[model samples]
Target chain A: MKHMTLLAGALALSTALTGGALAQTELSLWYHGAGNAVEREILVGIIDDFNSSQSDWKVVLEEFPQAAYNDSVVAAAVAGNLPDIIDVDGPVMPNWAWAGYMQPLQLSEGALDGFLPGAIGKYNDEVYSVGLWDAAIAMYARKSVLEKHDIRIPTLDQPWTKEEFDEILVKLKDSGEFDYALDLGMADQSEWYPYAFGPFLWSFGGDMVDRSSYTTAEGALNGDAALEFGDWWQSLFTRDLVPGTSQDMADRETGFIDGKYALQWNGNWFGIKTLEAVGDDLLFLPAPDFGNGPKIGAASWQFGVSATSDHPDGASAFIGFAIQDKYLAAFSDGIGLIPATAEAAAMTKSYAPGGPLEVFFGLSEAQAMLRPVTPGYVVEALEFRKALSDIANGADVADALDAATDAINADIARNNNYAPAN
Target chain B: MAAVAPTNQRLKTSLRYLLLVLVGAVFIFPIIFMVVSSLKPDGQLLRDTASIRAFLPVGDISLDNYFAAFKRAPVGLFVFNSLLVTGITVIGSLFLCSMAAFAFAFLEFKGKEIVLSLIIATLIIPFETIAVPMLMVVNSLPSIGPDGLTWGWLNSYQVQIVPFLADALTIFLFVQYFRDLPKELIEAARLDGARWFQVYSLVIVPISGPVFATAAILKFLAMYNQYLWPLMVTQSEQFRPVMVGLQYFFQLNTAWGEVMAYLSLITLPVLAFYLFLQRAFIASIASTGIKG
Candidate 1:
């Protein structure tokens, strides 16, 4: 009788343990930082913490290369095998949401209260994604070069006007001290074309598409302001103030630091490296005020729940946990992006006050503009890129802008304006 | 006159050799550049591209890129995955395609020509055209595994291998090679009371080395270099092949030296495979006039 009671107790204990293990649901996450060691490590740490923090869910991660991530997601969506969690580019979240690949994120009421505006992704008035960090662009110049040329160094509050900026470029070019006055990274023909140059259009009092309707690019793209922007843009290439579209990628990578160019418009991701190379001379200045205001492209990768996920609440819980200030600071320090929140920035090595890239956080906060927040923005961006490239290569600015407007309108029409009802 | 003729002949031979060497260099330059650049740092590698120094090992050279490449990704695992997939598929395809080819080449059956024609007709349909439909089919298909019967073959080795086992190009190559063989061998084997299977095993397959080599190499290359299909199917890195692994090196700031290093590592298997079968591949090409 004693042995029988012991056997029953042991069996009961084993069953209880097994039942507890089986009770935890598994959630799969797809991330686009497969080869980035720092990103992978930080993300893996977050997943481990999330899994251990709750008994209701266990998250599993699968990473894809950044270059191939979008295509892989689309393919998985078609196969109906999307994971429970997916990290999406902030600008691209609307397209994926519209295509029914991603659903709106679920977070606590004050979870994103202090997050940068660019780090919060919304489509159709519903929050779809949230990021740990954001990226900003600035004019990279050498303090020594600017001082030698008697060029006024632009600040967040007091930026160079259009005439002043143009005169600086001309002066720098005429000095014959550098191969080119500026490196716009024209050789990077990918998303950089639209992301880097679209801000110039905005600063010129034009936009990629009219934000009022988010449906057309008619006056917004080819109007008088845009035409002026386009002409000034083309003159940069025609006058040889900047390298043309045929610029070598190697030259673009090394130009400003190698002293081949006086100024380079680049992202904060390159800030630390340039700082290291040029030491105290490297300056990350605000974008010159063209006319209306200084502007820069915003948004980076963010986490969202997939539409196909059976456990969205669990996925949202993971995302909410990941957005903690510590994780945000870790990501910023690891990848050189501006932390999403000021609190996170204060904790980061670079984005903290008086840090090497401290100004970038302010730049992102003040000057960053999200790309057109609509599914049609994808096609619009491509058209804008082509028009800009054509104009830079000496095409008629008016004709190129007109063609881009027509193409964007055609895409909008083809997709039935990507209306929310559909 | 005789002295002049000999001298002219020597001059012609010398010019021919010179042209051949130049053409060879043109073909080999990119490979040399990849290997040499793999040994240099990214800065020197980019700087050297404008000169012939790109193809020369004359810089601050180290195997740092190779080490970094390994650290960034599972280089060995990717190579192993690709090799395993390619090897199994090539072997399976050779067997199945050759057996099918034997039926079309030797056997008399109803609608045999029609069947062969239909199989050949599929060659015109590009894989991209059918990829979506094929994905759907594979997703719905059933498989029995250690976990018992399961629907959807997604994220499995069989998904990569099974759909590619009976390709049209391999079948056509085997059929063409089989048709050219004399009918006397089959007749003699039959006269000696050998079954059709016996004839296939003893007579046809034993002598069909060139076609086997040709098909194996062609299929090996195809399976090894697959990018889109595997990318679409295998979501897990455990099953990702080298081509998909190549994307891992293309980060925001692409490490060019590491890219070259990764490429150099993945390319070793292909080079070794070709070298091992070069004699048979050449003989097959010379006889059959087929280009792989």
Candidate 2:
């Protein structure tokens, strides 16, 4: 009975895909954008165009807003009511992959090469998801503020040494033009902490766990470099620059726009909003690569095909089309973010008659660090962020790191015991 | 309660009024913020300070957000789905629960006490614990009539309404109310050669207006506020309830003005219903004893 029911479901899915009326394949795509008017208008037009361009398949667009996209998608998957395509973040790919929610794409035919080398690995051995946008982390500083204070930021191609970065912060502090020399959103441990601060630990040559044993009882929190970085991060609070609201949850964008923050640590996705708010006053630079370790940045959004989708072929083709040069260019112009494919970089330049976007894109390509693409990475990332936040608020560094390590270790044991390929 | 001097009582009453006003303002602050913020442009949603100067927007308030929200999704279809699913769930739950309550209260049956215990026991088990299993059960059922003879129960009004049919809490409430009824009246009706079903339909049901009203109001609110289950069952906006629709609207659109407008729009129906039913609830309460 179950088999027969599943067979009927399969038949129904195929019919839905094939546009049962036209007998053309119909595929439903789910995305969690539409935060602003620009994204909503652009995405709708793109889907409509995709639907009209084909005779064999018509694409249906469904949106889950960023706020509740994760919960909604998980619920949809549990109910076996998944759309043909979904836009999942890089950190979430492993969770979906391990849970058997994503379908592996047949990308052996040179299709995988179109993406950055390490990008596909985030989705496990099989190419389970395709990169949508380059959400590389970078710094945005107010050029006018920096210039008025006679402070020059290090170039996009150059790495800022620990001494140089500190010197600049000290200089800004002394200048008194801004309330804080930098606003990295340190107080909001749930979000800004892990992504903004995790790279610092890595740059200091510290690992969250000793990969050899992968056990919390035998973790890497005792390492000297990790403890040193933890203390340095805590200093931001000690210095009284980290703003604390009733909940210590304040918006970084608001701080920057109001001229309270001289420098903002965020991803490339905010480029358009920053531009719209402050215009040429914004200067883009790579996330400061503190020497002696790898530059760690975030890999942002990706598109995945649902395991239940009947139009995998057309969906895959649409994934390719969705990131095409023209659409990417137009989207980049409208949203001030990098295009998915490298080819769209040229178009991005053409769309914006400015230097910052291209400079930021180049820096993004060079220093981007793919966040750990493990199942349940959100839990781990969040715990790690909490450790840093605790340290920032004067908690013992060793204890905080130990607590985070214990949490991530437990998460790994429960969710992903699979030995990693890399 | 304490007895007070006349002057002290006057002071207490004034203080009570002041306290009520303060509490009311505190409760309504967020809603007011949402409404006012929605009127402002995107940039002003999170302004640093609120002053009388900034209470109203500088630019003209526009209905563009509402227009954009409707154009973005099928709002009409959503309203129809909400009406259909909520109406069916409310009505179906009322009838099934009342009948089951009547049987348990008045009829003789084997292991009646144990069965009643089990039915009530179901209420104690938190729905969260069984949500996964319950969803699997719902998904497993075909929405169409038996064996492809009709549309599978899924994505259908019945599928959306059926699982909600047997609510234990509702049954327990109805059973308690019906058990208190004067059995001689039901006995008299049955002795007149009326069928068992006829007694329930013609005599008992007609006299159970207050209890019926109580059950209907509770079910209506539950069905109206429902979000997750309806979202799971309905594949299209054409089958979504109001809460799910409004939530999706808020998610897709961040411009506060549009969100507030849509919120204010959807909230009216429930608000109106509540105002209409307030009289019924009050009257029912006035007549029923404290225990009932």
Candidate 3:
């Protein structure tokens, strides 16, 4: 009889465990890293940990390719079937938030204190999303090339002045040792335009739009500083210091590594590969100051809760759990991006102090500038890209800048200034 | 003089053969490139792009890319999904569109000309203009599935197949072909106490092989290459077609060899379908002056 009673007790415990497992709520997460094997493995690991860590929520992931992710999310939003959690690009978060596709994230207080500013997505004074890593751009050059050319290597505190950088380009071109002096990656005609070149305009004391108002581009994109930046940009093509808009993409990928280009302005994602190729001769220098302090465009992809989610708390919990330092380090090591926090960076193989690509961490901290943080940035980025392309193709700087400014102003007016002042 | 004439004829024949071979090479080079590149590594494929080597099957060739491509995405699933959707839609489109064409061509109906004109007019309206409205309609549609009733057809094979089963182009192809058929065939069948459906089945369809082949090939290509509509409607990866699956290869740094492998795999169905019906399709084009 005692043995029979013990058997009944065991059955009762098993039934209770099954009941608890069945009661766990499922949360769907949509990611934009569909074909990346490393990202998939790390994310699946996180999901497994999160699912087992709590009985209240079970997160399920759906991944889309980065190229098609935005369209998929927008389509889902239109169908009123968006997932509980969505991964959004940092610059694009404001637009999605304004469109009611996303809601402000709920996390523990002071959870983001040590995070990089660019890694945090804030709009209308609310945190809509947070990223695990940030990306930084640098002037990629071979130390041997710089030493042979008698060009002084620039540091974070003492970057090259505008005239010094221009002179170096001329010197490199005059040597005839390379096909081009600099590779600005002109072949990438997409977001690379604004993401890489916008900093040049900012360093020249111009901006895509007046950040204070988020309402107009007047006197910002078409100002004297912008025209100066544009003229310099055009000279890069007309003077043959850089390739034009019609540059071949194959050349862009292989030219710098093959010694056909003296220096390449590229992101840290390519740093490891270039380091592997060039060994001890590679250098990642700071961007030229251009009169203003040196700058590089910032922000990367981040996670947020969907506005239509039935369980925002559960989605936020998963996002908060994902931002742990270990996961951030894993992502950095996997994707070669700068970790969002110093602690995370220290744990990463590439971003840690004394690491080969460690300088990118300092660059991100010191020189990274967020793209115009407003819903109108979407239109602003496109116009800026078009204006930059036009200038590279020899359009009058002032005329092209004026057209971009007018276009931005018109969009702002059409949208009732995106967010009107009270 | 006769000997000289024979020599001239030989010269002209040689010249004609040369021109035909040149044209054929121009058409076949891209397919050759895709298949060849699919067997090479990414670095070798890219390096070969600037030279004639791009079109040749030489140097560091292997099937590693095809294996990697399969591992990266559900290549088999995507191809299967595309084939199933395209097969069903093509068969249904042939039956429904040909029947509609028969009514307009033979059966007397009220306001048929206006209706036919309106239907044909849709051919001019771009699909992109109507995609959003069509998406809205489909999102609100009801379907009977394993679950007793589902409210929306957002992520289903039926959604991809149904809206495309009776396109204006297919209907117009059938209508033009049916109208060109001898009226005496249909009249004789009707006089023999055959009904309208019987005349359509017995007298018209059996002799419409070339048109059927023509319409079937055109519709197959259109359905196989569908990207935008399926992208908007099918949210589940299980239901996505090959065209949308192509985006899976385009990451931050695209793997060109894998992309070529996926392309080569997807093109098999299209090439096979066309080759199977090329004789009839070519005959149809010759008689109707319609080019695919």
Candidate 4:
């Protein structure tokens, strides 16, 4: 009986030790890169590192497809089932934070210092999310096509002026060497509308919403500058200088590569593929200057802490650990985007100095601009998309802009101008 | 003139066949394109879209995209999850809904008409309208599982299965079909020593193949094509279905070839299922005039 009790005590002690070794608190993370094997592999590496590198927390990943990610997160938030760590789109981060789906990140004070401004998700003076890389848009063109046409290759400092870019498109169209002068990716009707085209509006001194007040888009969207931007935008389609809204998606993917389109206004995510196709002749030019300095849409997917997380520190710790320069470079190498910092850029194969995709890093540094940082920006972006789609289909530019302005203003008023919490 | 009439009849038949072939082509072309595209490189697949070549199995053809798709996502797991969820839901729905229909049709109950009407009224209310509320209710429901009595139902097969077992549309389909069943069959069964349960199992279910097939197909399609609810509820990849898995192919630079390959793979089960039940489903629709 005594021997049996001793054996039981030893068994209990062994079980306790095993339990203690497995006591790392599990922190759930939801990511929006479910199908991207390269991204998945690199991210799994980061998660595994963070899990093993610490004693207090172990992060578990749940990945959703990017298309369904936002709605899923919103629904999970409604059910109060949001995971501890969530990755959000950079522009949409404000809306999520406003909806109380996310909390301000709790990384160390200087952790974000060397990161690109676009890589940092800031709203109301607090950073709520941080991305490992920033995406930039550029004019994808063939150097040979431009040189053959005798059009001067523009630099970051001396981007083509609005008038020069317009004339170049006309010249290319008149040459009849291509089916179209430009492919604006009109087939993609989602956020691509606002992300790629909004920068043109900004260069024309117009915006989706008034940044100073975030209350109404009256002057910002329908003002004289906006009306001018809209006219130019519609003229591209009406004149057949660019593909219309009904452009086939397949055409958008292959037109430029097949030499059916002379140029494509696309993001850096396609930089590597285009480079492989066009080889040494490919160029990533800056967005044209239209009175204001040249600009390209900035920011990409980013990681943040969910507001309901009972373990914010652990969630933030994982995020902080994941953003180390090596990991950032790994992500950049795996997927072609601008690394978040110069240090990380130096570590990447493509974004490194004198590399093939080095120009994108420079373009991102010199010209990248974040979309309006407000909760109302989501509604504002939707209205902007509709307005642009209408204009492309030959609606009166002034009428489209005015309609967008009213809808945006109404939305802002409906939500009490999306007042921020102190 | 008799010869002319015969010739004209032949001409009319030829024209009808031509129109039928055209309509069939219109429906079948997308599937053909998907299968053909899945076997080609992304570049060739995209290039072929402009011509009749897209429908042909010519040029740079291989199963590279399908292989890449598998490497990219756990395609088999997604298919299994979808099939399992769909299979269980269809079986459960057929049984429970048919039983309810049996009771409504054979047994006299109080407020029967009003109750059936209420259940049918739910058909008009979109699932999206009540998705969030339903999500909350499911999250709070108690369940005994491997963990031994869990409070929430998130990230589990039962979560995907249980809430969908007896949706209103499936019940309505069963009720409509059961009502149309000859009352004499029920009367004869009751005149025997058989109980109501025995009649349902031994008699009504056996002769009700057409309705059962129709309901099974409708339920299977509905459950298999579920996107929003699964997206909202299944946070873990292990519980995600094929539709949600389809999203994995749409990165910033979407892999069109991979998307087509995934679609082709997921579509096989649906095609096989429909083909299996199509004869009975058609017969049911012809008799009942109920369009699914």
Give the alpha carbon lDDT tens digit for every residue of B154-209 in model 3: 98999999999898888888889889988999889988999999998988999999
Clashes of 2: 17
Q: What level of docking quality does candidate 4 show?
A: high
**Per-residue lDDT tens digits of candidate 1, residues B1-292?**
8789999999999999999999999999999999999999988998888788999999799999999999999999999999999999999999999999999999999999999999999999989989989998999999998999989988888889999999889999999999999999999999999999999999999999998999999999999999999998989999999999999998777899999999999999999999999999999999999999
lDDT of 3 by residue, A305-373 (tens): 999999999999999999999999999999889999999999989889899989999999999999999
Task: List the candidates' TM-scores in order.
Answer: 0.94, 0.82, 0.97, 0.96
Q: Give the interface RMSD values of the models in order.
A: 0.9, 4.3, 1.2, 0.8
DockQ of each: 0.67, 0.20, 0.66, 0.82
Give the worst 10-residue stretch by lDDT in candidate 2 chain A. Answer: A241-250
TM-score, candidate number 3: 0.97
Best by TM-score: 3
**For this target, which candidate reaches the highest DockQ against the unseen true structure?**
4
Model 1: how far residue B226 lies from native, Å: 0.8
The residue pairs that clash in candidate 1, if any, are none
Q: Which candidate model has the greater TM-score, 1 or 2?
A: 1
TM-score of 2: 0.82
lDDT tens digits by residue: candidate 4, B165-205: 88778778778888888988888988997899999999899
Better of 2 and 3 by DockQ: 3
Candidate 2 lDDT over A160-192, as tens digits, reads 777777777778776777788787765444455
